[model samples]
Target: MAQTTDLDLVHVIKRFGSHTAVNDVSFSVAPGEFFSILGPSGCGKTTLMRMIAGFEDPTSGDIRIRGKSMIGVPANKRPVNMVFQSLALFPMMSVGENVAYGLTSRGVSRAEAEERAGRMLERVGLKGFGNRRVTALSGGQRQRVAIARCLVLEPTLVLLDEPLGALDLKLREHMKIELKQLQATFNTTFAYITHDQSEALVMSDRIAVMNQGRFEQVGSPRELYHHPATPFVASFVGETNKWQGEAAGAAPDGTVAIRLPSGTMVKGQGRVADRATLAFVRPEAIALAQDSSSLGGLPNRFEGRVSAVLFDGANSSLLIDAAGFDEPVRAVLPQAGPLAGIQVGAPIHVGWTVEAMKVFAA
Candidate 1:
C-alpha cells in the first residue's frame, strides 16, 4: 500500500485583487520529510504558508494534511502548528508553561501537561530548564523552546516561517543544523520556508524554489544546484558568473557554443537556442594558474589580472579583470596554495572545462 502523504497542495492559487500571490502552486510532503519552500521576500512564500495554515483562503485548489482536505478548516482546528519568526512565546510564562499552553487550553490536566512539556523540553536539549523565564534564555535557547512548544502538541505537520531569521549570523548557522537534527530525532514532518539559500541547502531534505508567485523548481539541493531546470533556479540558488551571449550552435557531443559580445566563444551544456542565451560558471569551478601551460589545456582559458581578493576565510575568492569580458570573473582562491600568495594586479590565467559552464535560453 502507498504511504499517506503528510501535506499536499494541489493547484493552489491565491490573489488579492488582480495581483496573484500564489499561482497554481502544487506539491506534496512525505511523512517525516523536511521540506522547505525557498525564495526571496515578496515572492509569495509567506502567503502560500498562510494559506496552508488556514489564516488565509486560497482563490482555488485544494490543501490536504494526511489525506483530509483542509479547504474550509480554521487555523486553530487544523492539525498544524506554526513557529514564526517572532516565535510568539509569552513573556510572562516560564519555558515549561509556554510548552504546556496548548495542552492546558485543550483540556489536558495541568499535571499531565507539565509532564509532557517537560519531556518534550528534555528531548529538545532543554532538560531542567522548565522553570526559567523565556527572557532569560539566549536566542538559540528561546528558539528551541518555541520548537518544543509546537512539537509537544503532536500535530500532523509543523510549519516554520524563517524561524532562524531573528538570530545573529553565527546562531542562525548553528540553528540550521540543530533544527535538522531535531526533526530527524522526532521523525516529524516539517514545512520550512526561508529566503536564505544556505539555510535551505543545509537543512532541507527537499526544496522548492519559489519565484514570482510560483515554484520555479523542486528537487534535492544537489539536483537544484548541479542540474537546474530553469534559469531563475541557476541564478538564485547559488553564486555564479553570468554572461549574455548569442548561441553559435551545438557540437556533436551535445554542447552549445555561445559567442559573447566581446567575441569570446565558450562551450557549455544546455538546450541550444537560436539566438539569445545566457551562460553561467560557478566561482569554485574556475581554476587559477600563473600561466596558460599550468591549466592542463582546458577548453576555455583566459588571461586576466587580479583586481581584488575577497577574503572570507575558507570561502575567499579573487576578482579577475579577464580580457574580453565586461564584468570581472570570480575564481575561488585556495587558502594554502601557491596561488594564495598572488597579489592584486598580478597576472593570472583562469580555465574551466566546457561541462562546468551552464547555458540557458534568455
Candidate 2:
C-alpha cells in the first residue's frame, strides 16, 4: 500500500503589496519524508516557507499539517520548529543553555530542561561541548547546536531555511548526510529550502522545483533528473544539452520526433505534445560506443563530432557538435577507457535512449 502524504499545501498563495510571491501553489509531503522546495532567488520559495512556518500569513488558500488548517495560528503554536541559516543560537549562553532555551520558556524546571538539553546536545554529536559558549563553537558545530535546540522539543516537523548556507563546500556536503541521518533518527518530517539543486537532490525524498511563484515540477531526484517536466526543470536540476527542433512527428507507440536544424530527425518516445515541443537530454545519458554508431530507426540516435574534450579524473566531458544542432553538445564518458582516445576534432558518435530524454512543450 502507498503511504499517506503529510504536510499538504492546497492552492497556497502569498502576495505582498503589488506582488504575488507564491502563486496558487500546491503539493503534499509524505510523513517523515525529507522534502525540499528549490528555486532561484525571488522565485517565492522562502516566502512559501515563511507561510508554512507561520511567519507570514497566506494571502489566500489552505495550509494543512496532518489534515488540520494552520491559517491564523502563530509560529510558536504550530507543531513545527525551524532552524535558520543564521544559526540563531544565543552567543553569550553555553551550548547547554541554548539547547534548553525552548524547554525553559515552556515552564520546564531548570534541572530537567538542562538534562534534556544535554541529551539532545549528545544526540547532535555535541555531548561534552555543552559548557562551551555558542561563539566558541565552529560553524558546523553551531549549526548542530541550533538544530539540537529546536529538535529538543521534538516537533513533528522541522523546517530548515538554508541551514547549511554558511558552511564551506566540503562541510555543506558533509552536513547533507548528517542532516538526513538526524531526520531518520528522529523520524521527523523536514521541510527544507534551498536554491542549490545538488543539495536538494542529495537530501530530499521528493523535491518541488519552484519557478516564479509556482512549482515547475515535483518528483524524486531520479525522476527529476531522468524525466523533467519542463525545460526550466531540466536546466535547473542538472547539466543538460539542448537541441532546437520542431515536432517532426511522434511514433504510434508514443515516441515523439523533433527535426533538427541539420534536417536530421532525432526521435525520442516521451512527449504528450500540446504545442511545438522541445527535446531535453542529459549529457551523461549519451554513450560512447566501441562498436559502429548506428541504431537502425532506434529512438534518440544521433551523429556528432567531438568539438572539445575536457578530462576530469573520474569522468571526461566531450563537447560534440552533433548534426542538426548548431551549438556543441556535451557528453560525459569514462576517463580511462575506450573513451580516453576521443580528442577534439575527432569524429565521435554519441547517442541517448528514448527513455533518457524528456520533452516539454512550454
Candidate 3:
C-alpha cells in the first residue's frame, strides 16, 4: 500500500508583478514527517508557506493537503495552523484561555475546551501553569504554549515559520530538541521553514535548500552535508574551504584533475563541463600531520603555517596559510590530538584524499 502524503506542492509558483518569488516549486511531505524549507531571507519559502496556508494564492500549480486541492479555500477554513516567529500569542488572555480560544470559538463547550487545553498543556510540559499570565512565562515556555495552542485543535498539518528565531541562542538550541520531541510525540506533520542550517540539519527528516526562488537541493541532513549537489549548497550548508581552479582533465580512475590559479593540481570526483571550476573540502576532511614525512603519500598534500588558532573547546580549528595558496585554508583540529597544541606560525602538513574534495562548475 502506498503511504498517504500530508502536504504536496505541484509546480507551485508565486509572483509579485514582475518578480517571481517561488518558481515552479514542487515537493511532497509524508505523514508525520518533519520537512524543512531552508534558505536565507527573500528566498520565497515564506511565500510558499503562505500559499499552503491559503493566505496567498499561487500564480500557478496546485497546493494539496491530504490528497485534497486547496485552490480557493480561505485561510480560516484550511485544516492547517501556522506558528509565526513572533508566536502571536494573545497577551490579554491567560495561558489556558489562549489555548482553548480556537475550540471555544468553534462552539466547543468552555468546560470541555478548558479540559482539552489542560491536557494539551500537560503534553507540552506545562501542567499547572494554565491560569498564569502569558507574560509570566519564560521565552521557551511561551513558545511551548504557542505550539500547544495549535496542537490543541489537532490540525492536519502544522506550519512553523521560524518559531524559535526570537529566543536566545541557548534557548533556541534547547527548543530544537524539544520541538522535535513534541512533533514525534503527537505524530503530527510539521512543515518548518528556517534559514538556520544547524536547526534544519538537527531537526528535519528532510530539507529543501532553497535559493533564488528555487530549490537548490532536497535530501536528508547527512546526504546534503556529505554530498551536496550544487555549489550554493556546498557553501551554504556547512563550513568548507573552497579553491577556484580550472579543470585539467579526467584521470584514469575517473577523478577530474583541477589546476588552481596557484598552479597546484588537485583531484576530485565530479563532472565539470566548464573549464572554470570550484573545489570544496570540509574543514574536518583535512588532517594535519606533524611532519611532511608523516603524510605517507597522501593523494593531496600541502605545507602550511598556522596563521590563527580558533579555539572553541571541542570544535577548535586552525587557519593555515599554505604555500602557493592565495587564501588561508581552515582545518578543524581533533579534540585531543597532537595538533591540539598547534600555535600560530607553526609549520603543519595538511593532507586529504582525492575523494574528500567536491568539484563543481564555477
Compared to the true structure, candidate 3 yields what TM-score? 0.98
- The CA lDDT at 52 in model 1 is 92
Q: Tens digit of lDDT per residue, candidate 1, span 1-362?
A: 76679999999999999999999999999999999999999999999999999999999999999989999999999999999999999999999999999999999999999999999999999999999999999999999999999999999999999999999999999999999999999999999999999999999999999999999999999999888888899999988999999999887776998899989988898886458998999999999899899987799999999999898988889999999899999999878878987789999999999889998999
Preferred candidate (TM-score higher): 1 or 2: 1
Off by over 4 Å in 3: 1-3
* 1-362 per-residue lDDT for model 3 (tens digits): 76599899999999999999999999999999999999999999999999999999999999999998999999999999999999999999999999999999989999999999999999999999899999999999999999999999999999999999999999999999999999999999999999999999999999999998999999999999999999999999989999999999986665999999989988887888899999999999997898988887778888999999999887889999998788998999777778778789999999888889999999
RMSD of 3: 1.1
* Predicted candidate 2 versus true structure: per-residue lDDT over 1-362, tens digit per residue: 64476689999888889899999999988889999999999999999989999999999999998888999999999988999998888878998999999999999999999999999989989999989988888888888898899899988779999999989998998999998898888888999999999899999999999999999999999998887877898889988887667777777777777777677777665665664666777888777664444544345555777888787765668888777677888888666666687767777767777767676674
Model 1 lDDT at residue 317: 92
Give the TM-score of each candidate.
0.98, 0.92, 0.98
Report residue 153 deviation for candidate 1 (angstroms). 0.6
Q: What local distance difference test score does each model get?
A: 0.94, 0.84, 0.94
After superposing candidate 1 on the true structure, give the runs of residues whose Cα lies further than 4 Å from its correct spot: none
What residue runs in model 2 are displaced by over 4 Å at the alpha carbon? Answer: 1-6, 272-275, 290-303
